[model samples]
Target: MKKENSMKRALVSVSDKTNLVPFVKGLEEHGYEIVSTGGTKKALDEAGIKTISIEDVTHFPEILDGRVKTLNPYVHGGLLARRDLPEHMKTLEDLSITPIDLVCVNLYPFKETILKSGVELADAIENIDIGGPSMVRSAAKNYQSVTIVTDINDYDQVLTEIEENGDTTAETKAKLGAKAFRTTAAYDALISQYLTAQVGLEDPEKLTLTYDLKETMRYGENSHQRAWLYEDALPKSFSILEAEQLHGKKLSYNNIKDADEALRCVREFDEPTVVAMKHMNPCGIGRGDSLEVAWDRAYEADSVSIFGGVIALNRKVDLATAEKMRKIFLEIIVAPGFDDDAFAVLAKKKNIRLLQVDFDQKDEPTKDEVVSVMGGLLMQDQDTLKEDCHDWEVVTDVKPTEDQLKAMMFAWKAVKHAKSNAIVVANNERTLGVGEGQPNRIDSLKIAVKHAGDLVEGSVLASDAFFPFDDCVKYAGEHGVKAIVQPGGSVRDQDSIDMANKLGIAMVTTGVRHFRH
Candidate 1:
């Protein structure tokens, strides 16, 4: 590398000109020459900033509808040449090309184009830029002599450091270069995933993932460990992982985990529902005619556990609900939206995080889910919502009433939130008890009955998996469970149905099992 730092020359081409004017001005103020292409050049010129066209630098004109502009040898040679290598210098001299010290290039908005409903294939294909990734990779490969900037948010910081130090340090260049490669890699991964899905491909070997780090948490599960949050390709999906914090301290690892579980539980209900979660377990859950009533019922479900728990609501939070929530020491609260009055009421508790996520509209099932282990990953299909209730089979002499069937469905939804070997008992629209992560079905039923206490009378039960024996059904009858819903596939299904009939309890099979394990 050159021992002495020199005046920087930047190649700036971007489809998103969010901070282009100020960025180019900063480069000009720092004595850096700007070389841009096509619309980017026009944008800078219109913004009253001096710029050199890429055609002028390469001594060739842009052709093929702007696709052939920055792929020239001059551009790549300038970005890739090593200052310390004599052959590299000789090659550059032979080509009469000057080294590009910095590259601030972002690709065309392919993801944005694809996100638009009814977007044609031609439109999406045309948005994919060829030159942007090439220039980024070249600059990143030669990080010792080049600084690459792919994100507009980094523009001002990079400009400030260069202005103060004359040139970017090796550390800054290396960091920026790493980010640049990751940016292009993620972009390619997204394209591959989209195209593969578009063609109706079922090959699991073709699946790909692209994620970007949103923020680093204080710790993993505890304060002594480190953690970070990342999002997959889609940014429009308003997940707890994708939420932007409008106020309060950064989210801790436990806070995010609890908030995610709370969000998932609340999203399961179509009607207005409120769920309170602690340590990835639902402490309380309720649905009401109105959100305020639901919030109150959820709070009353288990008052002690609701303390410092994460609360999530399915509807827009009103002032009454916010006021009631403010009374407790909550870690976080999330809803689809908040009205002005509700926002004002909740804002008083500044320490709590309030997030708005449109769960009803954006609950698309993810294609792949990966869980990490000590040395590898376990991949599986995402747990998707089953919409067909009519397909469920009534397997008992005593069929459930319409109201009881609704409660059974609700209990089934609640069971999905519980851990494996889960059992949930509910009456009306409120969760009476949840038994989670038990070793067996009968044990789970016993736990649910024990937790439910007096509320188990006339309540409906939901099991995550099939009842292997009639012991669970007999146990439910003793707990006053009037109805039961489970996936029926075990060989002793007839015995279980016979037990339900003898006990005068209604039983149904969903055909589909929800095994969390």
Candidate 2:
């Protein structure tokens, strides 16, 4: 039933046409027949490369507007048949099917389609490739007898092997098979994520997620532990990974973590702002009319704590700000952009990493925040909800002045980013002190008051959660705090309210808690 000395067959179908002509030409040079479908076949024909159409092989017209073209048994049987097994060869011979020795397939542009501006749901659904994944999985499953090519980067490797060894090696086929399965898995995960969001399914029965390996870090949080960075499949436009590294050595794990915290804190302000981050906590935050003024306020807030911290700015870095920053040792500086003179001044320090993140991109949508536990994972919606000062309820007898209310909101924003059991002491436009991650609220308040020192006289106070007891309020009063802002959810909220009134401290309840752990 088999034709004597027939050429090997390579089934090729891909949405990305990168290097398709040259790769197919090399396969032809190796005495392989090119089998393609739809747009791929037309492209091959235009490139003057001969190709056998899927319709010709299946002996059926492509129905459903070309969706049903490659789903036929003829194509799968050819790809799935094993050359070494006599029964498989007999089944192929009985069905008059040629053994397809290779399969080159990449799915449609579903990710690209969904990412397009104002794309409709129907448009996204139509772009999903059904037959391509089926073919890729079949070819990958039979990798013991068939070679699978999913990545365009592997085209040369496949060609080099064919040119040198007449066939791809067993190791190469196995690796490609594993890669193909990963590709299909990631593709399916992305589709599931998109559809789940479209249907407003908050908690899906099965949680499927995918990420791309962005970098292999030198180490994890510690030097002995190994770690790598995996970026989201659809990364947010405002993420640190989107930033261009203007100068300095590669970012360390700590550098990235601190820089991310700084960026998140700085984005909370609309005016020119600066945030200084150490570990994962903001040591200082400042907003001003000019970038230089903001830098001065942030630096003067806690000059000692910000010595080796990461700095994030919402505006472009100017020469004056750069000169001030050059005086201190900083791990990284992240900003929207940097002037030429500013860059030169900062680049003078060989070890500081400078990152330029675009501030003009559209606002990012809220995403799920996932944390890994020992045996399970915790998932929650990201806290991207903007808080309005007018929504706050005044719970105390003493009403806050406009300046004190502004300071309360400023401290509230800063405290939201700090770890739980956090406290922030701030003026109208700058954070004087911050304390977080304490075992008790009073202890955190004490640390914040001590950090603020003499500057705590007229500054307002913000707590991530309600006061468990009146002790925190009394301590804030003793420190000369002018006003307090908190979520006010505890059963003893009245006690804290009573204490605030006794101390003549204005208190506002946000009715919303921001707990970062």
Candidate 3:
């Protein structure tokens, strides 16, 4: 007699049972016996569709709270046996195992489970499905004989092909097998990363990264290079990927990079602030009591560079701010929110992208920043440290006044976002000039002072790193800079200090460097 019946036998186990009942009913219509376990069987039986319990096939009761149900050899033997091999068929017949032609399995919701707020460790561990992945891998390995279905979206296609051909074609089986393997791989990578973080394991022997494709960009930094954007599987709250784009054309590769830079810089200020960025560098950063004032100050900081640059605001965009922005040509505007009239005014500029990012959400304490190099990858912790002016030490005889100290802090925050070797000249709340990505610190200083021009006098300066020589300090003093802050670690730190005291300029040592590369 034929094993089971003169028809196909399918094993189905899934956490997501969407469209499962109808699909199984269709299979039964085509003379296939449905075998299921746990919730799947209950749902099928409730829908008036007959299902053979897994115990009937394995001859073993599910133990350990349904964990050991489908891991039995009877289940694996049927799914993994090659119908083309005579010995495999004889062994199945001797063991009385019915050959399983189809295996439809999707793993537990591990990613969703761990993402829950205050989820217990035991709960997350329990949600890690062991039997499901085993079945998927086994069936995928024997794709020549067993068809695997892991995605719910593929139900219609698979069912249509089976209806037309009486069985899934070999080509369809191979494609489904490849998709199943990819699903399991991504699932395992997420689990590995979560467990690694729980154990505080740094630099594991194997590094696996999983990301979902968010967008396919028109091009990369250059028009000739093809590019795509991938968001982190568990994205941060304050991310460009999380932002809602209200208006404008699709974002290009350079637009995303510049918008990211603008967001990072704007986050450094809690007050009403605006950050202007171009080509992944800050053109100007401004802070004021109101959003409109902040926009004016930021625009005044670098009116020339502000053209065709990204603008990020920490406060809601009002009609006043929107009116001021409408006068210039900006590539993008990002804010916490935009008022009705403000959005209507700005939306008229069809080419300008409008992004509303939520600033109320808190970010994780730490995140891994990854950069890909030729044939290798580099990973490091993102620089999110908040510097306190109280921790800084004054090294010069000329003491900075309270106003000057505040200006130095403002400059520090601006310089942190600029590229190295970076320098920022600012008064109290607005950046007068920014110079970055120069070969030498003095050259950066010269560029900044030139940008400042008449405004250089009575302004405070901040550097990302210590002065290698006393020349930068001497140059700043001659240019009439009132105060300076740098990570004082150089061997010639005293020389810079002596120069500051000689020129009656106040100098502060932060003992920390903020280098952005």
Top TM-score hit: 2
**Pairs with steric clashes in candidate 2:** none
Q: For every model in order, what is the number of clashing pairs?
A: 0, 0, 0
Question: In angstroms, how far off is 358's CA in candidate 1?
Answer: 2.6
**What tens digits encode model 3's per-residue C-alpha lDDT throughout 446-504?**
98998888999999999999999999999998998989999999999999999999999
- 1-517: candidate 1 lDDT, tens digit per residue: 3223356689999989998889889888777899998888999999998999898998998898887998888999999999999999999999899889989899999999988988998998998878999999999999999999999889877877877787778898999999998898888888888788888886657556887788777789877888888876676465787665655667888898889888877877888899989888786789999999998778766788889999999888898898889888998888878889888887788798988776655566564667889987787776766645566899998988889988888888888888889898887778888788878878878877877889899999999999988999999998799999999999999999999999999999998888775
| Model 2: per-residue Cα lDDT over 257-362, one tens digit each | 8888788888888989999999999998988999999999998888999999999999999999999999999999999999999999999999999999987762
* TM-scores, each model vs. reference: 0.89, 0.97, 0.96
> Which stretches in model 3 have alpha-carbon errors above 4 Å?
1-6
* lDDT values, one for every candidate: 0.85, 0.91, 0.91
Error of 1 at 136 (Å): 1.5
Which regions of candidate 1 deviate over 4 angstroms? 1-9, 25-33, 46-51, 160-165, 204-207, 242-249, 319-323, 338-347, 359-368
lDDT for model 3: 0.91
Q: Model 3, 329: alpha-carbon shift in Å?
A: 1.8
Q: Which wins on TM-score, candidate 2 or candidate 3?
A: 2
Q: How much does candidate 2 score in TM-score?
A: 0.97
